[model samples]
Structures are given as C-alpha cells and as structure tokens.
Target: MKVYISGLYSGTSPQPGIGLSRSLRIAYPDATLVGVEYSNRSSGIHWLGFDELWLQRPWEELDLPAYGQLITELLDGGALWISGTDLEALWLASVFPDGHANLLSPPAVGLSRITKPGVEAHKGLPLQIPPFVSTDHSDWDLHAFCRKHDWRVWLKGPYYEAVRTKSWDQFEAVRSALAKVWSTQRLFLQAHVSGYEESVMLAAYKGELLGCVSMRKRELTEDGKTWAGDVTEVPEAFAASLREIIRDINWSGGAELEMIKDPEGQRWLLEWNPRFPAWVHGATIAGCNLPAMLVEAATGIPAEKTTAQSEEFTRVVLEVPVRARYPLPPLPEPYAG
Candidate 1:
C-alpha cells in the first residue's frame, strides 16, 4: 500500500516529521511511503529507505482546480493522503472534491454556539451539546457570567475550543487576548472543564473502531495550549465510551477524542480532533504505529490491535526551537472557484 503524507516542511530542525516517518518505516518496512514537502529546501536526510519524496511550493499558492485534479490523480493511483498539519487537515476536509469521509464534521454549529449567549443554558442532551452564548471579543461582562454560574463556568469556542480560568480577572485576560485574535480570525470560547483530561486516538474503518490507545494528561500548558503526559493503558469503560462516540459520529479514517474526568471522576466529552495528535509519536513507541495503521485503513485492510510495549515506551518532551521568525508571504485571497 502507498501512503502519501502531506504538509512535510523543511527547516524543522530535530525533525518531528522525519522522526514520525522513520518510526513508521520501522514498523512496516515493506510498505511504500512518500513524503510531500510544501517547501523547496530539502531535508537532505536520506529517508533511510522510503518510496519517494516530492517537494513543491505551499499548497495555498496552487490553483485549486489544478490541485484537485492532481490530488484526484494521486488518489486514483492508490495513494492515501494523511495530513500532519491541522490547517492541512481542515483544508482537505473543506476543499477535497470527493468529500472523503472525515471523523468529525467541521465545527460550524460548535462555532455558532460559542458566539450566541444563553444557548448552553439548557443542559446538553446525551451526545448533543446545548447552545450557548459566544462572543468574538472577550470583553463581555465576566462578573455577570460568573454570578450566573455560581463562580464556576467554562470558556470555550463554538466547536469545543476551551481554556479554564480560576478567577474572573484571569478569564478577562484570556478574553482580551481572544478578542484580538478573533478580530483577525474566527474564534470561540466555552466554559472551563473541571476534570481529568483523557485522550483516545484510534484507527477506524468507516466508523468501525479497529484499534485504539488512550492516555491521561499529566501536564498541560496554563491555557491548555499543549498536552504533555504519560501513557497509561486505556480503561475498558473509557475505551468503550470512545468507541461509541466514534460510531455515533460515523467517522472514517483517523480520529481522536479528548474527554475530561469530572469532579465526580466521571468522564465527559471535551473536544474532538479528526486527525493525529502532535504527540502521536508516543503511541508509535508503545507499538501502535498510527501512520502504518492509517496506511492499512487507506488500503481497505483491517488493522489488528497490537499490544503496546510498555517497556519500550518513551516520553516525549517538547522544547521551543530557537529560530528567528521571518515575515510570511502575503496571504492569498480565500479560495474562490
């Protein structure tokens, strides 16, 4: 089976993408893997043993019609496209002509909920979320919101993007920052969740959960920006809940769900990502090679769950790379065709 990985960029030193690719190759030595870099500069790292590498200008600069045609050709040639970047995954879900099955529907309704107030006043139904008020600007009356919720509330975006603040003052700070961001881009805010954060990453075939691995969050950024944690074997109940959620969504391909353990130690659904996590390499170390399983899913083969090698597990620690930020090129007009 041929697997095509998109959004491979050069200049990412200590190379996260290459490290992921190398791990995948180690798991499935005979499989064909191709790297598609969006930049002209080559890594020069001999991919060890891989099928091919294609470097081109960023996809945003390409003509949509031609790019779609090219992608269709590649898919026709039996390549399953897996995205390593969030924007790329969103773009693929939005722009792909085939409307290939995605794990979660784009956050249209979720975004709407964040903007409109009093929407989430009603409790969420079993699996459906209640509507809530939202603002593009965070300058709303925090005192009023806190008073209404008895000083306990969550701040999140329409589609479940969230940040927790212990006090109204801190919440206001987050709101101000979000307001500035929303002025330039779409944003949402939701109530803070008080619970343990757990994530389940799975390989699925047309909504059927084939294999999954779950982990609990150990450390998180103050604003919940990045996840840093150790891997624990998923509890049976949590794994079942995740499988049920995926089945309900009728997801296809790769998907991940983040759940929170409430004060009562009950898990509540948090947010859903229909693609691999940034720290998914941790799973590869645990013996669940996601990239390869994705390859298998793409090729119509069922992937068997492999036992996680607890002894071989490695903890991933991320440090900000020192680099000068260059001015990015002018933004292209939104894709209109």
Candidate 2:
C-alpha cells in the first residue's frame, strides 16, 4: 500500500517533518512512501528518501479543480494521504474530509471546534482553555494587555507560529513576522502562565484511544521547542481527560495536548496540535511506535502491543544528503505563507 506524507523538510533543522519520515519508514518498511511538497528543492525532497516525490502548487495558488484531479489520481492509484504538516492536516480535514480513505483524523470542521477560540462551544467536553483574544495584528496594543496581565504573553497565528514575548517591542516584532509566516493576518493574544511544558501524544480511531505517550520537557532550544525530554506514564485521571477530549470530538487521528504545569503543580492545556509534532519519533522509541500503530489502525492490521517503555531523548541536529532528480522542472514561485 502507499500513502502521501506532506511536510518532509529535512529533520536536522528546527522544522516540521524532522522525525516523521524516518519514524514512519521504520514502522512500515514495505509501503511506498510518497513525499509531497510545493517545491522540488525543499530539503525534504532529497532527504525524505521516499519512493516518489510530487511537487505542488503554492497553497494560495492551488486551483480547486487541479487539486481535485490530483487527489482523484492518488485515490485511483491506491495512495491514501496521511498529513504531516498542520496546514495539510487542516486542508484535508476541512477541504477534503471524505475524498479519500483516512485512518486517523477528525473532519476539519470538528477539529476547529476545540482549537478555535471557543472551547465551551464544543459540546460534551469539559476542557480548561487558556484565556485568549484574537487580533488582526494591525493595531497591536501591547502595553495595555501587559499592564492588565503581566508582561508575559503568547502571540500565535491561526494554524502555526507561537512565540512568548516578554517586552512590548519584542511582542510587536515577533508577532508581525510570524503573522506573515503562517499566512494569517490574525493572531491569538494569549495569557502566558509560568509553568513547565509537557505534552501528551496519542493515536486514536473513531474517538477510541489506541495508544498514548506523555512527556515532560527536560530542556528546550533557544527557539522554545522540545530539545530533550523524558517520557512519563501519565496518571489515570489525566489519561481519562485525554480520552474524553478525543471521544467528544470523535477525533480519528494523531494528536497532541500541549500543557503547562504551574508551581502549584496544576497543569493548563496550552494548545492542541492538530497533527503529530516534530518529536513524534520519541513515542516509537518509547515502545508505542505511534506512527506505525497509526498506519496499522488505518490498514486494519492486528495491532501491536502499545507498551510504555521508559524512553528519553536528546534531540540533536544532523546533516542529510541533497540530490536532484533527472528531467527537473522549473521551481514553483516561492511560498510566502
């Protein structure tokens, strides 16, 4: 069987898809791994080591008719798409929910029920959402918010890009740049509570929790990503909350609950990553092999034992090879999003 995996950027950089390709291939050695990217030169194009690579139109330039044809071809050829980037995941869920066979994921609209500003609006779920206000980032009023709450605040974009700013100037600069990066004019001005960051990564199907691995950050890169972390078997109560959240959403995909634990030792759910995060390989090494299990759940293989081995990791940057395919086509316009 074959599947298309988006976000194949080389893993050495602080980018998405770092661990995805490696982990997925390790889990399923027989399947054809097709890599999808907007540009043929994307580091992932060379380093993904996929069986095939397909260049795509820029997200903004993607004509609906053309994308539909591409999807039809993949489906006819028996390739199911499993998203790796937040953008692709959102697009698949929102734009083409029933277009192909999906193993794990909620419909795009259902995903928005929890991630969008109003968690209370999502019925049947009791979730503690962080206080946040949406802004267009045009008339940014950094001082007023800082005066009301402390100087700490998290500036985020619609789908990706999150930065914690400690000063008015820093807030303005970071917010301005990230807005363009994520291709959204709006931003989420969120209350930044002081706490240790933790993540609970899971694989589910039809709201059923197939497997889970929780981790507490041991160290972070200067850019504020999980650089090193240790796996911790989550308490049953917390695990129950995770299951309830998924069941309520009927979520059928890979997801992560990012949280912050305060000095009082209470955790606050920070944000929900719609797809697997960069550090997903940690789950496989931890004995869950989530990506593999994800494929299994999708393919109906008798599931492997989802064991929680005590695994810890130190994420390190490394180099990858770059090669060009024959009969190359002209590169697409650079993506501004």
- The 10 consecutive residues of candidate 2 with the worst lDDT sum are 118-127
- Candidate 1: tens digits of C-alpha lDDT, residues 50-127: 467765566668776676677668776666666655445555555552345322222222222223223331133232
Residue range 156-221, candidate 2, lDDT tens digits: 776556777788788779877986776665777788778889988887776677778889889987
Off by over 4 Å in 2: 11-18, 98-100, 116-127, 136-142, 169-186, 302-310, 326-337
TM-scores for the candidates: 0.65, 0.82
Relative to the true structure, how large is the alpha-carbon lDDT of every model?
A: 0.54, 0.69
Candidate number with greatest lDDT: 2
Which 10 successive residues of model 1 have the least lDDT summed? 102-111
